[model samples]
Structure formats: C-alpha cells, structure tokens
Target: MTAPRQRTLFGLLPWPERQAVAEALRTETIGGIVLVGAAAVALIWSNTPWSEAYEQIRDFHFGIPALGLDLSVGHWTADGLLAVFFLVAGIELKRELVVGELRTPATAALPVIAAFCGMAVPAALYAVTAAAGGGSLDGWAVPMATDIAFALAVLAVISTHLPAALRAFLLTLAVVDDLGAILIIAVFFTSDLNLWALGGAFAGLVVFYGLQRFRVRGWWWYVPLGITIWALMYNSGIHATVAGVAMGLILRTTPDKGEGVSPGGRVSHLVHPFSAGVAVPLFALFAAGVSISGPALAEVFTSPEPLGVVIGLVAGKILGIFLGTYLAARFTKAELNPDLAWADVLGLSVLAGIGFTVALLIGELAFPGTEAGEHVKAAVLIASLTAAVLAAVLLRRRNTIYRRLYEEETLDADADGIPDIYQRTLAVGANN
Candidate 1:
C-alpha cells in the first residue's frame, strides 16, 4: 500500500477548524468595513472647517487620578481600547501556536519565514530610503504590519474565489506579523524604565497564569485582575497593550474535560466583536485624521521618513512576501498548495501591503507628537489605499478565473455525484 500523502504547505484545513476560521473571517470582514467608514469620517472631519474641534477632542485629556491615568482621547483609544484589540489578537495567536497552523514545524515554516522576511524587507527598505534622504530611521518598523481586518475587507469587497488555504495562509502570516510588531513596540518604543511598575505587572501576569493553570474559572476573578494588570502595565512604561497580550497568552487554549470551548477561545469569541467593531474602528477614527492637502500630499512623497513608509508598504511588502514564499518552496521541503498558483500568491502579497492599524500605531510611536508623525500617518494611509486598489484589480481578475474553474468542477461533481477533490482526499485517508 502506498503511504499517506504528506500535507503540502497551505493545504486544506480540517472541517471544524475551517468552519471556525470562516466564521471569524466573516466577523472581521464586517469590522473592516466599519473601520474604513470610521477612517473616512476622520479624514473628512480633519480637513473640514471643524478641523480644530477634531484635534481638540482627540487631544483632550481626562483620567483617573488614583490610577495615574491622565491621557488624551487619542491615547486612550491607542493605549486602552486598542489593548482589547490586542488581547483578541493574542488569543488568536495563542490558538494558532497551540492547535492551529503554527502547531507543527512543517506546517508553520512557510508562513513564518514569509512573515519574518515580510517584516525585515520593509524595515530594511525604510532604513535605506530614510538614510539616503538624511531622515531619521526611527519609523523603520511602521510598515511591518499587515492589518488583517483591512486585508480581509478588501478580499470580501473583491468577492474572490480564492482557495480557503490562501485565506488561511493570510491569517497565519498576519498572526506572526503581529507578534513581530508587538516585540518591536516593546523593545524599541519604550522610554522610561519603571521597574517597580513593571515588576508589579509581571506579578499580576504570574497570578493570571496560575489561575489558568489551576483551571480557576469565573469572569469575576479575571476581570478585576485583568484591569489591575493593564493599569500596572500602563504605568510600567511599556505599552499597555503588552499586558493584554500577556493575559491572553496566559489563558488556556485547550478546553478542560467536558467543556465545549477553551477559555482562550471563549474569551476571544466574546471579546472579538468589541475589539473589531468598536476598539479598532474608534482607534482608526482618531489615528487616521492626517492632513491630505496638495502640499501635504506632496510631502508624503518628498519627506524622507514618510516616503520610506510608502515605499516600505507598497514595494517592500510585495517583494518580501512573494520572494520569501518562492524561495522557501524552492529550497525547502515545503510546497505550495496545488490549488493555488504563483499569481494568486502575488495578489495575496499585494493584499498584505494594507498596513493600517499597527502601522499607524508604530508611526505615532516613532514620530510622537511631531509634524513628521502626521506626514508619516498620511503616508501610511496613502500607501494602504494604493495597495488596496492594486490588490483589488489583481485579485478580481484571478477571482474570475477561479470562478470559471469552480463552475467546471461543480458540473463534473454533479455528473459523478462526488467531487474528484473529495474522492482523492478520502482515498488518501483510507490508504493511511
């Protein structure tokens, strides 16, 4: 008997996982649309007669004096609300690392390599551009992120007939990309070293993990602890979002005996809607209000830092991801899924260039409160929009081709009463 076939990279997901991913994608698609709308409103309002009001609202500060939390509206969204978003991200990442695509070396290699190269190339390109133009290289990491929500939204808009594996690949790539972005923020963006607060935050995380290890259950137990950890983390001089991710990672992803879902999965399900629909969109509403005038638009191209951001997102991401995938398949045991073509990979690479959310966060950190910050934000917006339009054009054509193929496949399956694809899959399983 022939041995069971080894799964190729980006191969089909199992049914249950596939269903979960599909549901998550649908939710994210809606969130992406809402985020885009919020961004548009921010841009229009920022440029209108009430521009000052927009700025005033974003810059206004109020806080809990007891908690040492005095922050502007924009900071609250970025540091506070965005923590909820990161917590959800952390849960997703933990799931992938534990039981999803990243659980094994063979399945994880391609996307992980692609994600690293994707980040490195953009940072390198940004460094080259910024240094050549005598600009600071502080914003080198801004374009390293792929906003999954925006990318998914673009795919939904295009009505792509791309394989499910392709979407799974994007999701895995984005998860790794997020982890990289988080590390960069923690290492590069932090200023004051409040060791006391940091230690306190770490202790809270330990207790959080202990609770998970003991299988201690209850929202009451977690909610207050989560808040205290977040507050301490904020005071610790590291980004508060790091606390959110820490708590998420500490949560158990595998369900206890007789449980329907893992704690991490349950929390992710409950929190994901709020994270995507409210936290993320609200963050975008505050972050994407950069000036887009004739001169400001010109500055995105002329200014060294902002220009680097544009190049990094539009050009660097494409080259990084495509080349990384190709080289891995060429040299390693990893193989691209047979259902996808190089052209499909190219389109997905372009789609990865829609670096909106974390890109804006990095830009804010890199240029904090400077005129350069605004220009860099504008560059991000411009580059992301350009990437989205280009990806739409390419994917739409590919989608048409795939639609035809799918129609033919469906017709053949109807005649045979069983699809050839499924027949082959069953045969392989039977052989095993």
Candidate 2:
C-alpha cells in the first residue's frame, strides 16, 4: 500500500525549512553566548578594583580630530561597530518583506501585531511609572526593545525541542521591534537637523543604490562607499546606524543572472561573523560596564526610573505579547499554528523580555552622563538577568513536552516510509 501523507504543522516544518531555521539559530546562539560572556566580564571588571582602568580604555580617543571623528573607544564601538549589526538586521528585514513569512498579510499579521503591542505596552508602562514618581520621561523607550541575540540564546538553551515556527515567530517579532527602536532613535532622539549633511547622506544612499543596480560585486568596492554614507549620516542629525540600515535596504535581495548569491545575502554573510562575534560583544562590553556598588544598588532600588524599567520589561512584555497574539487571532480569525499551543506562546513571550542591547543604547541616549542614566543601565542589566532566569525555569518544563512531540514526529516504524505518528493521524482523519 502507498504510504499516507504526513501533516505538516508548525511543530514540524519541512526538512529544508527546518534546516534553514536551524542554521540561523546556530549563528544567533553563538553570537548570543559571546555577547553575554562579554557583558558578564564587563560587569565583573567594572565593579572590581580595576574599574578606573576599564573607563580609561573605554574613554581613550584617537580618531582624526579635523573630521569631527575624535571619538572614544566606547563611542566607536557604539556608533561605528554596531552599524554592522544593524546592517544585518536591515537585510534580514528586507528578505522577510520580499520572500519570507512576512511576504503575505496573513502570515505577517500575528507577529507584526504582537510586536506593536510589545513596543506600545512597554512604553506606556514606563511612562506612567516615570511620570507618577516625578521621574524624567525620557527613558520611556528603553524598555520597548527586545534583544534578539540574548533572547535567541536563551531559547537555544532552554527550548531545544521547540517548534521551528516558534523560533521564526520570535525572530520576526524581534526584527520588527528593532525596526521600531531604530525609528524612535531617528525621530525622537535626534539632535537639531543638519540639512546639508542630511542631504549629502541621501545622495550617498542614491549612489549606493545605483551601484547595486549596476551589479557591483566586491566588498572592497562597497566598503568605502558604506563608510562615506555612514560619515555623512553621522554629521546629519539622525543616528549614523540608520545609514547602515539604509544601505542594507538598498542592496538587492535576490541573485542576479549567473550569480550565486544576492548582494544583500553576500554582504550579510561576510559581515554577520564580524558583527556577531566582535562588534556586538565589544559594544556590550562598553555599554554594560556599570559599577554596581552597595550605594549603586541602593539607588537602583530607590529610583523610579529603574522600577519603571523593571516592571516594563518583566511584566509588560509578557502580558502585551500574549494579549496581542490572542486579540490578533480573535479579530482576524487567524488560527494559531496547529503544532503550537497558547502556553508555548506565553513562555516565548516571557523570554522576549530579555531586552539588553538596544535598551542600553536608548538608556544612554535618554539620560546621557547623568545619575539617572547609570540607574537605567543597572536596571536593564538586572531586568534582563531576571527575565533570563524566569524564562529558563518556565521553558524547561515546556521543553520536555516538546521533546516528546518532536520525537513522535520524527520516528518511523513498521518499515513505513512515513512516521508512524503521521500514519495514525491520517488514519484517524480518514475515519472521521
């Protein structure tokens, strides 16, 4: 007899699809581990007796002074190096829009809605708390971000048996969250507009677009152009990282004739390693090195800013995402993927509260060089750690259930070409 066809659910994707997600997960997991290690080292070093040395290294400046480039090591890591991470983000965003799950409205609705809720609810919570306590409202956006590397790393460790669709959902939600953070930085956190420099940045972006249209093929040719665009954007009032995203979006997403890879894919492939392994870790190192002495810890507890941030990240993220997902499904008649459960979504949503990277950036922008800023940084670190611990505890239980399901989906018996579970499923469906 011909073997019965298997039902594909979010729990068990097709092999090729699973392979793609697995590879992406592997990359993010490694990067996440490195990023976390760097942050931990920074925290330890900063709080130790050698804290001044860490500050000295971070504050050392050596770039050309004439070109307005005399930035400290910390600034360079934050502004220059982190652009690589944003570039990869932009490329991934484009791919999703053009050909991935986000290509269709139906597929994109849930995560997009959840991402929006995730951002909005956190901002509202922070604002309300900050305002009620007579604290500055500047850092409201700090809690609105989801650190993809940190979250994915946590997932990789605790959710090894989770469905591929869950990974994809988290990835897409985080990407959208990053995009929202970028827009906030550009719009609300900008300095006074510098029109001439802004115009120059746009001109460079146009040229960069033209280069891609002409099928320009080498990293060497694009590097200088990318730098020039970054410089112009830096001089513009907008954050320079937006330039990287613009360039990334400008690159073609699909391969040209006789080409093995698209420009976007090629650039991402070349830059991801550097961005993940070096740039992000270095940025985390500088950004995370906040001294947390007894006094500092006391300040974190007494400060309204940290309290708001903590609540926003830990409580706001989970409630917002779960409610948003439910509302989206309810109003749109979009069913949750068959292989996943509401409980799985709840666990993943809780894990999403681990906001580290962009939260630190916004904290700096919101309260630069102030006591409040330091408190905000301390709060982010603490909140992320809390979220990580909570997620591990919650997801560990769910992991056992998923592991059993995963095995059932993969196991074949009776010399059949199909998994025995699927055969039984098909037989049950036929009887029904």
Candidate with best TM-score? 1
lDDT (Cα) of model 1: 0.90
- What's each prediction's clash count? 0, 0
Tens digit of per-residue lDDT, candidate 1, span 1-432 = 999978778988888886675466347677898899999999999999999999999999999888889999999999999999899989889999999999999999999999998999999999999999999999999999999999988887786566777788899999999999999999999989899999999999999999998899999999999989999999989999999888888888999789999999899877876787789989999999989999999999998999999999999999999999999999999877766677878898999999999999999999999999999999999999999999999888878776666676677786657667754333322422
Q: Candidate 2, after superposition: displacement of residue 189 in Å?
A: 0.8
Please list all clashing residue pairs in model 1, or write none if there are none: none
lDDT of 2 by residue, 129-180 (tens): 8888989889999999999989988898777776677899998899889899
Choose the strongest candidate by lDDT: 1
Candidate 1: list runs displaced more than 4 Å: 1-26, 422-432
